[model samples]
Target: MSSTDIEPAESRRPARYHAKREAILAAAALAINEQSAKGLTLADVGRRVGLTTTSVTYYFKKKEDLAAACFSRTLDKLLEILDQALEEPTPQLRVRRYLSLHMARLARIQAGQEAPFAVLSDLRAMEDPLRGQLLAGWRTVFRRTRSLWGSPATRVHADLYGARAHLLLEKTFWLPVWLDRYDAHEFDRLEARMMQLLTHGVAAEGQSWAPELIPLVQIQDDETVNRDAFLRVATRLMNEVGYRGASVERISAELKVTKGSFYHHMDAKDDLITACYDRSFNIMTTAQRLSDTVAGNHWRRLSSVLASILNLQLANGEGLLRTTALTSVPAHEFALMLERSHRIAQSYAGMISDGVAEGSMRPVDPFIASQGLVALQNAAFDMRSWASTMPRERAVALYASSLAFGMFDDRVLEAL
Candidate 1:
């Protein structure tokens, strides 16, 4: 017999290997959902799959490889949503369909209809190789959505539109879990309000604000060239690793500088975190100014502002806000950040009020609606950081659509 000739048994090896790999990945996702990705191990996955560690290793050479496989599988589900959304008749309807399906899927996940997946929550923990793979997957999904719309303008709109979708899905599905509450009807209203806001401007009918009359301030720094590069690196490191876990030594090593040099820039880790909060505030304020200018109906303007806020959080680099939430920063500084966040909320509420007065919005409680909308968006951000499988565009689209439903007039929501 020729060496090139293979028996039927050998030919089936590849098929069997693929099935084994799928089982291992499914087991890993279960382990992660129950105990978090940090606690997942090869042995845990093997036991869950009723296999020996050695047999599991036959598919995934290492625990990291297994983790990557689990993460990819989760992303595959998200991509499936995008695929369904693209099949809709119009770009606008495509977006609506996408949001509806995403919400339903999220509900299923929350109801324990299926095993929990941790790709989103553990994305930051993934090694670079896995992170790259995830990003590539996201890009492919976006590209497909863009192609379906077939217009440059629609593609641009799709970016923000898609982001809103992802944000809403994550918020609706994950927030209730965090708060230990389940209100499907409440989520439905939230989704409707978000869509209304995205499609219409927040300013009510016959109401207009003097756009050019808004005041602008100028700031002058004497030390124009003096930048706190060390503090910047330190903050990012601390945010990524947590204050207790992040060492000055690691920061110094990352910067390729000496410990003495790091000490020259900051007194301690606490000081660095405080500085980061200050910097973040300034950046956030600037973003608020830009978002405030989005001109359209009351709903549209409000959606634009909300979209800007979500984008800012995502762009600030992962883990910064999470670190702020989980770490022990100074109480005074924490209070200050809270005040700043409150101010943003107040501004958003004012826009809603403006819309209500102008007849563009129906009679509704702007204060309660605004607070609820902001809460929904913030929850979505938290969930996105946690799930890490859904793309930022999809998250934002989902959130904006849901929030618009809660905030918009019933008539406007019905049109969307």
Candidate 2:
């Protein structure tokens, strides 16, 4: 054939290739929704879209590359939303609209349809250039977000408003795990409950922060165990900020102790971080085992487990490391925390599966439900600042109910 005769076929090939790439990206996003970017595999994504793993690589060579692409997509979507939110005349209204719109989008994404934006499974998984680019983009949105409460001249005041807004926005990002099939009405109710908790704090009704002397390894013995108060405060700092952001110097200062005191207990900052993850996972697993013995079927048992986790986070200082995903830890310790965390998630899923079999709970995807439950459990730790505002029990009950029925009262859910 003449070269001209083959031109049309060759031209169409690139178009077809780009279309396939887009399909793979969409499929990857859905798969990541099920099991974040860290847990996602090229093979699984390929299977979901009816492509071979080898074929999938033709579009994105490495899983991290694909992950980076996913992260970029989510970041762009987030930036777009933040931009639209800025169009609102006031900051609070902007924040509310941003959240409500984002919640509705979550429902769409989980349902395997189009969404307003995308999400990243693991930020650390992406390369520096890609990760930095996306994060820088996010900062722009955040700066605008901070302005919602009016620009505070004081850094601390600005931070408080930013923290509250970000905390509320962060939880909705994980709603796919909680209510994959929710409608507009459900999103509105869920948003209302969230806003209520956000503005008023999680104090159940008339109660205020009633400090109890609950022990959490609350042990004060050896230098490694608890010789200094730095570790306890470190746990909170790490949970509130992150390991990188929670440096030894900062943590020591926060405890009103010297760096020497912090050094006296742990070998280094990384070691301290490792210890924190170890302690956090150990506490959660212990709670899980204890809840396993609670009276009733899987649903009740799950509730008891949720209660135990939420209360521990609220009651104990060490439980302050509130991240649901462990990828944030240094790569070396990632596997250990992830394995243990996965087991915990599975235990939750197993309970849902059991309840379904036992006829004690409504039908649901055990895997997604378990992941959703754990996400809620982890996020509850962030409510510590608000915990002091009300009765801890009331806050815990509200969290439990929110997990069971997203944006719903039990009565409202039943009527639906």
Q: Residue pairs in steric clash, candidate 2?
A: 74-118, 190-407, 203-390, 204-394, 207-391
- lDDT by residue (tens digit), candidate 1, 201-245: 344444322222222222233423122555555555554534544
Rate residue 164 of model 2 by lDDT: 43
TM-score of each: 0.56, 0.53
Give the number of the best model, judged by TM-score. 1
For candidate 2, report its TM-score.
0.53
Q: lDDT per model, in order?
A: 0.55, 0.61
lDDT of 2: 0.61
